[model samples]
Target: MKLRAPISTAVAISFGLLVLLGIFIPDLADFRNRILNWAMLLAALALLLGLFNLAQVHWQRVRGREATVYSAALLVTMAITFAVTLLQGSDSANAEWIFNYVVVPIETSLMAVLAISLTLAAARVFQQRTELMNMVFIVTLLLLLVGAGPLFGVELPYFTRVINPYINNVLALGAMRGLLIGVALGTITTGVRILIGADRPYGA
Candidate 1:
């Protein structure tokens, strides 16, 4: 009774697997859509729980004066975003304006900063001459960056016509697709582990 976690996990896994098998099992089709809707509702609830948890943690940090300014900014951003979302009713012009101006620019700036940081780190790795993989990585990185940008790819009419297309479309796209597939597989594996009670965060 004290350690029946595996049994509980097994029961939950069996129920979920039966629902999931509805995709291929014709007999389960009647319940499939209902089960999926329930799953989606649960997922939405989980997201709200996450947001509340985030707010709580940041509020605590603000009260403690640990990185108070950043925590305050985060809370303010969340409040404004939430208020706008509710007031504008999701599809309204004001909601779109907030998303386009406030959210998009912040996200774009973060991505730009990330790219610059990665480029600098790659450059530093190249300077060390430590491993063959580092050189290969740097070469691939440079090709993708240049081939995707106007600096060398689009500006040069020849590259825009031939070289850039081959590098960006054929090579880079193929690599990215492969990476996405790997990520999907990894996600499936983790989900399976959770179902099987092999990954037991709930027990903790």
Candidate 2:
């Protein structure tokens, strides 16, 4: 069992290294493409599995009479969406109508909920501790809100055109890039640790 873990880790790391090399090394392009195709197929399978899992959970809830209304609604919606896509074809006018009217509104509602949740969290943080970081976050959020010119339909040359663009393009972009870099570095470190068998997240 101990030997199996080390061998599997080594094999996994070898493929990872190969894929990394393929990004910069021209000779490994074909190998990388093949790997990517496999990944795509796997992703598709995973998505299908997830859908099945969702359906199963909802069906159980319906059967148990636990949140039956919500479960039934979800199942019905899924059925309608699937049928529409299959029968009318995804690009058909019927599908497009459903996407635009039904799907879009639902998505927008979800986003609004998320925004409200974030706002509440921010408010709570400010209430707990009036730190410099929290103050900066509030200021940044306000700037972004003001920068959202379409919402209010009011534009000031100094604030809207000059300051908004600077905050969005320069300040926001810089922070996003820094965040991405941090994520990449963390991923690399975790990968290295796994490769070295220092971290064994998978079953033994």
Candidate 3:
């Protein structure tokens, strides 16, 4: 046997135990809630790690005199954002305004670009494959877009008549139900694996 036992097993066990405790023991609910809070705290730390990594990479680029202009801009933007966040606090009016006007607009633009790229990619897939799955996907996407859009004057009969209602009520509800079921199954499986000492993700 290897000197270092796999850390994953320990992680899986802890996760499994927590999952079961959350589900079965109502009195242990507070423990589960605390665990969730800790998880979120850890997630925030991970985000900080990302910011650290970004700064490190840009600093190295600046030092090496490669793409120094872009590096400097990144550094400056990060510094300004960090300072504003720290001084005014993340929840303050100034921070909110910066996030709303600057960050939200940039994020929206990026999302739009990504959506366009995805559309092109999907179109290419349909062109290449020409399969039933691709046809179904394209049709579903078109239906979804038309149903969601505000086409006031030129109302398509099929969409306005049948598909819209079906999607809004039946499909949406069904999707949510499916998602809940999947989550439950995943939790159960994870818990079982952890209890059995078979699936440890943490180094515990």
Candidate 4:
């Protein structure tokens, strides 16, 4: 018990350094791949454990005296989906039916709700601040929404052909690339912190 934390930290630091070095050092590539494979296996196990934990929590909620119809429904749906997928295989017609009809529709509906919510939030922000950037954001958002599909069953050539394509292809693409760069930088920073033992995400 006393030596556990130190031993864990040492192992983590060594593995991190080895993996980092392996990226640039060809000699260590094989070792890096082996370590990565083990990490993947561990990650899969962790995911399975997390799923079981989720089901257990939902089961507890369903059993509680409080009105938890949603929990019960979720548990039942999850069980049925899992059983179907397992028995029929993921590529089977029944599994595909559940994924296509049930999963896709739910995801699509959530995305629609998210789009509406974001639009409303942007409107509220514009109302409050009315800054130049906020004004631009609101205008661009409106243009994107309006040009996303035909308006009043008629497609406007100017918006549909030009503005929408330019906004989506150029402006939005640039913004997404910037976001990806930011995420990459943040990940590197986090990795460095973990490597240096400043962060102990592995319960060291």
Q: Which one wins on lDDT?
A: 4
lDDT of each residue in 1-204, candidate 2, tens digit only: 446577667767777777878999999999988888887998899998999999999999999999999999999989888899999899999889989999999999999999999989988887898889989988877777776665556565666788788987898899899999999999999988876667767665
> lDDT per prediction?
0.82, 0.86, 0.83, 0.90
lDDT of 2 at 146: 71
lDDT, residue 30, model 1 = 77
- Against the true structure, whose TM-score is highest? 4
On lDDT, the stronger of 1 and 4 is 4
Model 1 per-residue lDDT tens digits across residues 94-183: 888889988899999999999899878887899988687887778766765665658833475564567767877888799999999999
Shift in Å, residue 20, candidate 1: 2.9
**Deviation of model 3 at 203, angstroms:** 6.1
Name the better of 1 and 4 by TM-score. Answer: 4
Off by over 4 Å in 2: 1-11, 113-128, 143-155, 165-176, 195-204
Model 3 lDDT at residue 78: 81
Write one digit per residue (lDDT tens) for candidate 4, span 96-139. Answer: 99999999999999999998998788778988998899888889
Between candidates 2 and 4, the lDDT winner: 4
- Per lDDT, what order, best first? 4, 2, 3, 1
Residue 138 error, candidate 2, Å: 2.6
Q: Alpha carbon lDDT of residue 11, candidate 2?
A: 64
